[model samples]
Target: MLETHGLTANYGQFRALFGVDITVAAGECVAIIGANGAGKSTLMRSIAGVIRNAAAMVVHRGEPIGALSSAEIMKRGIAMVPEGRRLFASLTVEENLLIGGQARKAPGPWSLDAVYQLFPVLRERRKSPGTALSGGQQQMVAIGRALMSNPELLLCDEISLGLAPVVIRDIYAALPKIREGGAAIVVVEQDIGKALAVADRVYCMMEGRVTLVSKAAEVTRRQIHAAYFGEAA
Candidate 1:
């Protein structure tokens, strides 16, 4: 339900994305995989409105929302779990999630209890400071906070960046439930296998360009290797 057409982004004079084109259909999960400096996060930010662009660059459903402020974007039903799991250090886990619900009161199935059910540990840690939780727990809070918004489209940037494998598996296990709620998801992940496992389609990028786009089940390791690093596999 989201599309990026000839999207480009810049930080001052340094360009981060170059005519990047991608699309996410309703209720589907899409993965973007690339190494550091590959602009995956930039693409996510551009769509999330952290980096603005031409009016037609980013579209949702059928509307052009390229220049909307982040708050406006959220109100329109897109919520982002930023790359760093940027939780409010002062707020408790429950309070942090409450902020998300307050931001966008859209009607959906993602309530506080629903989020807790998706990540049970979050309920147990509800009274703890958001940042005081373990890395994986913190990540759950970030995701829960975004879900609390009851968004139509969710942009998750690096949700598995630095967690243990078991924890990562637990985190990824929640994707199906999310999609079952009828929200499309765009995940920016470095773990190619993990991304492929959860996504229906995948985009591989390198040096600010999309090198390959294919169905997750059909894209081969060799293709991903070449697309990711610009080298023969």
Candidate 2:
């Protein structure tokens, strides 16, 4: 449902992505895996409209949206859970979630109660400051906040960045339920195992270019290792 064609990005002439092409089909889960500085997050930001590019660079369901603002993109049924889980420090857990929906009031299955159902602990601590939550709980709130927008495409950047294995597992375990709602997901992750485990297709990037693209079930660890390090097997 989303695709990028020759998408390039730069930070004041220091290019971060090089002619990167990728796609995520409706209701499918795609994983982007790479080492630090490999441009995974850059690609995500570009697609989500955080970094502006040529009008034809990014496409959603056949229309180019690369030039749209991030807020406009969210209104167009795409929401991003940024790398840092950048929740509003002053807002309570419930308030943070509430604001996410206020931006784009599209109708979907996600609601205050529905998000609470997805992460039960969020319901219990609805009135607590969002920053006061534990790391895993904070991550849950981030995900919940994104879902509040009822987006058709969800961009998750580094959802497992600093959490424990069990916590990561807990976060991933929510994917099936999320998918059941019919939203396509793009996960930018550093945890190879977790990425491969939940992805239908995988793309490995290195030094701002796509080095490998394969079906998750068909890709071998050796292939991932080779692509991740830019080496030939």
Candidate 3:
């Protein structure tokens, strides 16, 4: 469970997010969809504590964590698969995954074997350098790396970016298993169809604010189109 209230972030004088509010319940999957420069990633970074803000702005469960460091947030049961899938270039695939659990060693179902089960290809390429893998395999490694932490909340920023359609589908197919472990997920995605397919609810942002929040099954294409582009529709 996570909530953001009146959340705002700035890069010097230029503000990126303006009072963007959103919430994710335990085991719930929430997707954030927007065009480029819409602040979806900004909101993810803020929640992950990559961009510091007021202490009371972001809350995990019931405690404020806006000002906490990224490591602190990860320690508090939140792990992020960042937009670029920033895996360690020098580490082997298995080693990269090992680093994720090293930071916060908590007992859970996600272990090296569990991750390999989730992505069988990862098991085959366990000894390969992380950067040596294909984009899809690399993404799997990123997701697996995050899962190694056994987080209660998973922040996925652009998980589907730059992947082939079949690969994206393969990545999303792993979500049910992730949820089976009771981890709430926040997915920031540009692919509206994929986001809607995997999320229970969806939030659409424009500029720096949430313009629409609706159940994935209930929101229509016209509504999302309007919300995405700031159009009257």
Candidate 4:
């Protein structure tokens, strides 16, 4: 459903991605695992159009979307949860979700009620400020907010970064239902076990390039460690 070919990204002269290639087939769940400064988030940002790249960089369902704006990409069915769960602190929980549908409003399997069902606590905290929620609840709100867009591909960057183990499990437990709803997923995570547990395939990056791509079930822990740290196993 999504592919990046020779995707390179730069912030001024400091390039973050170096000819990175990635693919996520329809209905597939892929995870990107790498250490700090490995450019995992850079790839996600490029695909989401938050970081512009060359016209040939990112392709979605066979069409090029490298130069499109973030809003344009979201309208085209690519929604991102972002690295830090960047929710609008001023917006109420319900209001934040309501805004997520403002891009196109194309009818799909997701809506306010369905999102609340995915994270029932969100329903109870509907009127609370986004910042008032705990980190786990805030992450749920971020995921629910993305689902509100009813996207075909959901890009989750560092979804479990700072959450507790139980909270991470709770967050991941929502993936099956999300996949059942037919959204292709690409998750960028530092947690190897979590990535392996939920991803159908995994890609490991080092210094802005993909060094390893394998079936999650087939890739060994040592292999992941090597790719993550740029060391020989």
Q: How far in Å is the alpha carbon of 209 misplaced in model 4?
A: 0.9
- Cα lDDT tens digits for candidate 4, 1-233: 78899999998999999999899998899999988999999999999999998777899888999999999999999999987888898999999998888865878999999999999999999999998999999999999989999999999999998999999999999998999999999999988888889999999999998989999999998898788777887
Look at candidate 2 and tell me the lDDT of residue 157.
97
Error of 3 at 23 (Å): 0.7
lDDT of each: 0.94, 0.94, 0.93, 0.92
* Location of the lowest summed lDDT over 10 successive residues in candidate 3: 100-109
Clashes of each: 1, 0, 0, 0
Residue pair clashes in candidate 1:
1-24
Off by over 4 Å in 2: none
lDDT of 4 at 161: 86
**Tens-digit per-residue lDDT, 16-81, candidate 3:** 999999999999999999999999999999998899999899998899999999999999889999
lDDT of predicted model 4: 0.92
* TM values, all candidates: 0.98, 0.98, 0.98, 0.97
